[model samples]
Target: MSKIMSAPTLHHFSSLFTLFIVLLHHSNADVGTASRYSPPYLPSGCYGTEATQFPSSNLFAAAGDGIWDNGAACGRQYLVRCISAEQPRTCIPDQSIQIKIVDYAATAVSPASAGGTTMVLSDKAFGTIANMSATLINIELQQV
Candidate 1:
């Protein structure tokens, strides 16, 4: 009789444990692709040449369609890190940067980013986490 009672408790415990693991994984990060953009960061889709548009650190990005969210993503901050890339040794491990969304990739000039990338990071931000030679790289992002 005692064994039968324990079975249900054990099953409940397992279910709770699975839920905890899933939540933990999601809290860590989300994977996406990022490409780099050069100077002339002004005249952004969001700010449109505002005086204080660019961050002092120049750690900024232009949102792709997936993240653009119809202008709602403007000024949203994200913690980003390079995870992988097509070129070998493209990622610089143990490095991550916080970037602000200042524009939309679609409207940015100078080949803003690779087609279908999740975001177009500024040259400074891209160099911090990945090799500048890489046109696009996999990234781990967490909104903060």
Candidate 2:
């Protein structure tokens, strides 16, 4: 009789422990992502002026100081993906866009916002990937 009662209690404890582990794993799945920066977009960047025009279809980016030092980013291209957008309704999932590094961001651009900012992108690139009007969106970037 006592053995039977103890068996049920042990089973219940085991079930609770399993559930706690599952919940913990699920919650931590996206842990480090919050530290990642969502970059912003500019319609016309400082790279090209009115006299020297740039096409919007040409996806370009301004590398932040943290990523590239002393103009090393120029001429480099990257495979960039919009992982998430600020406005959930405007987000187009999993779109990847390639962009060239045409400019550079000042060191001040670091910690640009509380959310963080990794780079500045051209309007066409941002819109194509994010499919949103948001000024900033989370992205995954890889060198090409």
Candidate 3:
């Protein structure tokens, strides 16, 4: 009996192990639907005209009822990844964006996506994880 694996066998085994790790890495998070909203993202329910409220990276989001926590959610940062969507291949591979919660989706002065979204990402934040054409995407949300 051979105790050592052949080169090809070892490569295959390593690939499988890597795949398992990638899958496991993304699984530890809350599953939710994320929609996008455009600019003029001011008069936020939390900040209310504070210039410093919005991040320069443009990665920011508004909390839906799921995480709103009655205004407690404000200013919380989250790591979000596009997991799935109505159309296939919408999620950008190996991509995730960190977003700060600047407002509440229901009460934001800016126009947001249709109701019932778990998070309303800013336009730039939404585009980072998924195609712009996708109006909404399934997201893996994790507070960091």
Candidate 4:
């Protein structure tokens, strides 16, 4: 009868929906775990250098300017030079923060003119500690 056939279809649809939900849940869990650990993509024995120059624009913004949306999470650990608007001419304070490298420029420009390497930070990381909008900071890679 039609009712009997409809019952089998309903059961099949429900089972598929359950499977989809399980897959979605599993994928989310995997992403959460992955964030806690550094990606394996960084090669062994690779180390970043300290920046002697600073760029003209906010380092964080410059770094993120041309990157994809995924760049929001791109920061890594960095040793940086921080300067306040009160003392713009000389950058005296030194700090360390984890920043994501968002842009790759063959030549350096703005905030501070780092030779060839540059990086950006998440809005939270940039704003909270470095004060990215008005403060200038120089970031260098930290050896792992």
Per-residue lDDT of model 3, residues 1-144, tens digit only: 869999999999999999999888855589999999997888898899998999999999999999999999999999999999999999999999999999999998877766789999999999999999988899999998
lDDT of residue 24 for candidate 4: 83
Tens digit per residue, CA lDDT, model 1, 1-144: 354548889999999999999888746578999999998877899999895988899999999998999999999999999999988899999999999999999998657657788999999999999989889999999889
Model 2 segments beyond 4 Å from truth?
1-56, 107-116
lDDT tens string, model 4, 28-66?
110000001111212211122333222323333223223
Off by over 4 Å in 3: 1-28
Candidate 2 lDDT = 0.55
lDDT of each: 0.91, 0.55, 0.92, 0.34
**Candidate 1: which pairs clash?**
none
The candidate maximizing lDDT is 3
- Considering lDDT, which of the candidate structures 2 and 4 is the better prediction for this target? 2
**Candidates arranged by lDDT, highest first:** 3, 1, 2, 4
How much is 96 displaced in model 3, in angstroms?
A: 0.5
RMSD of each: 3.4, 8.7, 5.1, 15.5
Lowest-sum lDDT 10-residue window in model 3: 21-30
